[model samples]
Target: MKKVLFATTALIATAGMAAAEVKISGYGRFGLDWNEANDVAGALDNTDATNITSRFRLTFDVSTETDGGVTVGGRIRAQAENRDGAQGRATFSSPQFHVAYGGLRVNVGNIWGAIDSAPGLYLNTTSVGTGIDGMGFNSLAIKGAGFDTFTSAGVGRGGIEAIYSAGGFTGHVSYSKQNGTAGTSTDANGVERTALMLNYSFGDYFVTGAYQSADNGRTITKGGVAVEADDDVIFLAGGADFGQFGATLQLAQTEEADSVTLAGEAEVGAASTVIAWVNSTDIDTGVTAGQTVTDGTAFGINYEYDLGGGVTFVAGYVNTAADDNDNSVQAGLHFSF
Candidate 1:
């Protein structure tokens, strides 16, 4: 309570400040979640959770500028678990710092890579997809849903990102490196990613393309599967709005290559998942020297209606893993502030 009061007072104090600014914003939502087995023959079955989905985020946006017309800014945010989960205290997550001048900006710390933030790469729906945060039935797909390229490494290491804009065109680039190595298949000893994205918005339509190389990549699945590899992922997406409705479509592909890196994931019968639900092999790739690849394709589409007042109705379906023909459906009201 005391901290809240102090923070409120500080916000009020900065409200009228010109060279500096402070703002707080976030979102909240609740809904049902249903999941089904990917393979009826598999022991894994269907599950459902009702009336219990919610998340709260608090962000402190701060900025100031030197007399030279250059601006410096940063954001500090705290997020709780996505479902009926509690936090003992605010978990300040994804802190980022930036320097800006005209149309160019450079960022560092807790940065999302280019493919991760690329426009059109993912829909802007509040309930991004049918599965909340892609941990539900959507997980059955190889991509595990969304156009997310989020790195688990966070600032356990650090990252640098840059953004630029001119007229209707924008570009983004990012790089990050992780410390420590993996055993046979835990977190990698190191992880590196380089990404680039370009976007253009014209009239009522927008187009975007992105390329990313996940180097020394590391990922673990809910089924206790792990893989460390270098990924070459490319993405293209676009969206357009006609009157009150909007639609989007995206296509993504991963390059296939021999293993300089190894893949390990739980073997559900003979099926071993490559990353999340991203790719799999029916036959064991072997615990060691397995050649894993996610080469087919992943795609998504969604539609949304603006209800105004920071609220919108959203519904969408996704083929989380294109190779498996995995899909999920969701519809919900999203609020933004």
Candidate 2:
């Protein structure tokens, strides 16, 4: 009787151990940055600028496989940022929820855009003016232009998407809608908006194209004052990887203007470097936006070091110049787990 009881207890213990698993992890970092620009509009005042900024992230996840061949899992994340109280915000950021089943992944809540990728899942050091900073997705200004094609850098704003991956090939498609108050239309005049984007990735190559159109209107105050304005933008990007390096190029054109970006990066040890050039011109390329890029170029390079246990050191530099030209500098650090 005693031997039988011990065997039953051991079996129950083994079953309990196999039933659940929990993981907890997070990371944070803080540093300083500076910027100086010549002949550029809306540039940050990085002169004599010094402060401490940090990012914190936490993730909880669990997975299980049924008696059949089905598997299911879910994860949640919370991110926080701070900047020596000078910035006055400790907002939680990053993809908030994620789940996967078989070859499909359904990001049901706040999540990183499926289309966004970088060397270390950190920032973008491309655009001299408004790139993704060395810590996250693409330039928000560029990606947030009321478009439905790019999966958005972070958060759905409220939407749905489906993705499938088989062997080394993958494909995805998504749709979303947005609305807003008066006088705040970004792509158009009013606030109603819709976006569509599609893409395919195989092996070390990817290609994506997207389109966005918005409702917009303006009030002309006299004579036949125009009361509305309509706008739309189309974007395309493609790239390929060659083991130790990769390259990507982007083009964005709107009813009123167009811009182009060329980006590439290489990996070496614990660090990687990135460089990009952009040129923006109005519908008429000859019309100068004053010293700004009727035809311009920007370049940047970044080095990253993982300090173990979820800490990272990131340093970067950027220069942009148009005919009249402007140049600037930016560098900082970030941490997460």
Candidate 3:
């Protein structure tokens, strides 16, 4: 209660002083999905999840700039899954706030880190396709069910991000530590994850590479049982354009101990298409073989229409196949105001 009041007061103060600019923005989308399964392995089963599913995002921002190439900004956002669940209600599940200065960004509360240049923070877009096939390295096909990358569905501590971009070289690093609720120790130790990226662009060709690492332990049982694990993700991508035709290739791999994803996207006229595949072999470290799955593939195509005004329409479909047979069809519209 006190924290929320303080935040609201700060916003009001910003509005009352200087040239405070306040902007309210949000977007909503809904889609129906059909699923088919051959070897049901996940919770949704092979049954068709046919229903009007929607997501809502609301954002508030206040920003100003100095005469010396310095800028300061603050933002608050709320996202709701399954619109019918709770549209306008205050849900503690989706609340994030942050303040930033120049190239340094400080985030408190709940936030997700962005590292993958091609994927970054956009792994769960309706147009982003499914599994390792749709958007390849940019897809959230790997996030656990009912898990939100930002704060682990509020089952952990808040997240933080630090980023800097200069000249042709840009770099970003982020970290997140999750701690369970006030009463339970379910996710007590939580998970510690971090990502770093470096990118450079020149003329009609651009290239970017990134690495991500995570340590998942903190909540393991006794008897010296070590559920703590680590992984190294590396990405290398480049793109070139010639007149009306352009092409892009992205290759990413992780220590075989985890998984590897390779993907490519091409732009022809106003349309772009993506094809990707992934093979994840859990380093049994001690587990079993057949149980240590590996084969997974994804293919997709996307179309875009520029509406002149800062508005665009994007739609796509993806087919994903893996140890657990799963598939989904999705599309979305993007507009900026």
Candidate 4:
């Protein structure tokens, strides 16, 4: 990371403001990706069995402290990525602004949702999961649900959130409303969501719970007819750490599906680490006839070898839960600054 301090005496002299700081940091990753699903024959074959994957990200964070010890800050990111044969143009993400005082903080614009920020919701890995791009995040406990997260490009989820932490407990709440016609009728087009999350940590263990409700948003198909309805989701998770080994368990439930995940991580040596997870889900297809319910299991394993100075070698393998039992493997290098 790099920091640049600016004395705004000339610009903020009348306002009597202190100096501000800007920090720049990001990461780069590149590797080879191989997928069994992409190596198929006939009309569905477009991508090669093996392809190069790469991404570059640069983030800018600006912050300043007020005379009363309050902190104000904002963050924006520029990112680009290439997968298979398609390359994306560099793009700048919408900014997220925050104000903090002690253990309480409030955020507006491109805000992080409560459910997405819950502890133990994600695996303990350098890239959050297996492979360079998380291999589609198949290991996550939450399945068939939409939630907000930090967006590296485009407008993102426009929302407002508040986070508070004290002692060993933390609480988060978020709300967002998309642009469209809003009403209680089944024909309503707009979507509104509200979420809450709470967590408590003690020693090397922690527990978390989160809930979210969507108003007249989720779509369900019944008898070949698409219908709009409300969705309510709940998530629970617990984790513990014992020396060089740690484990987490997560459970999630929604109107359409239920999922469970178990993840573990261990330090192999001074510079090596391994992580793995297995997930099982039961999904309701929402169709009154034909294939009303289905169940599947997926798993992944990842390994990382630190090369010092913000660089590491990473490799991973994943077996998806698709009906065809698709699988993928990736190996690459990741470096951050």
TM-score of each: 0.65, 0.61, 0.66, 0.89
lDDT of 3 by residue, 221-307 (tens): 223443323345556666665655555555554332333344344444664333333333333334222122244455555555555
lDDT of 2 at 143: 24
Give the clash count for each candidate: 8, 18, 4, 0
Provide the lowest-lDDT 10-residue window in model 4. Answer: 1-10
lDDT of each: 0.53, 0.46, 0.48, 0.83
Model 2, span 208-255: residue lDDT tens: 765555554322222233321223556677777887777777776654
What are the C-alpha RMSDs, in order, of all predicted structures?
Answer: 10.5, 8.8, 7.1, 3.9
Q: Which pairs clash in model 4?
A: none
RMSD of 1: 10.5
Overall local distance difference test of candidate 3: 0.48
Q: C-alpha displacement of 210 in model 3, angstroms?
A: 2.4
Candidate 1: which pairs clash?
Answer: 141-321, 142-277, 142-278, 142-321, 180-189, 181-189, 182-188, 182-189
Give one digit per residue, the lDDT tens place, for model 1 in 1-337.
5445655666678776664666677665554433333333553333232224555666677878888889998877766644423222335566778899999999888776677676654334354434344333231212321222432223423688889999999999888876664456564456777878999999988888877776555443322344433455666767676643455555654432211111112222331111211222122233233334443433334445666666655554455333443555545555666
Stretches of candidate 3 above 4 Å error? 1-16, 38-49, 64-70, 83-109, 112-126, 130-157, 186-188, 216-230, 255-294, 305-314, 323-325, 331-337
- Which candidate's lDDT is highest? 4
lDDT score for residue 327 of model 3: 54
Write candidate 4's Cα lDDT for 1-337 as tens digits: 1332222332354365557766777899999999887877652556687888899998887888999999999999999998875656688899999999999999998888999999999877767879887888888888766887879878877889999999999999999876653464555556778999999999999999999888656676655765433357899999999989999999998766789999999999899999989999988666443332247999999999999999999999999887773889999999998
Worst 10 residues of 2 by lDDT: 135-144
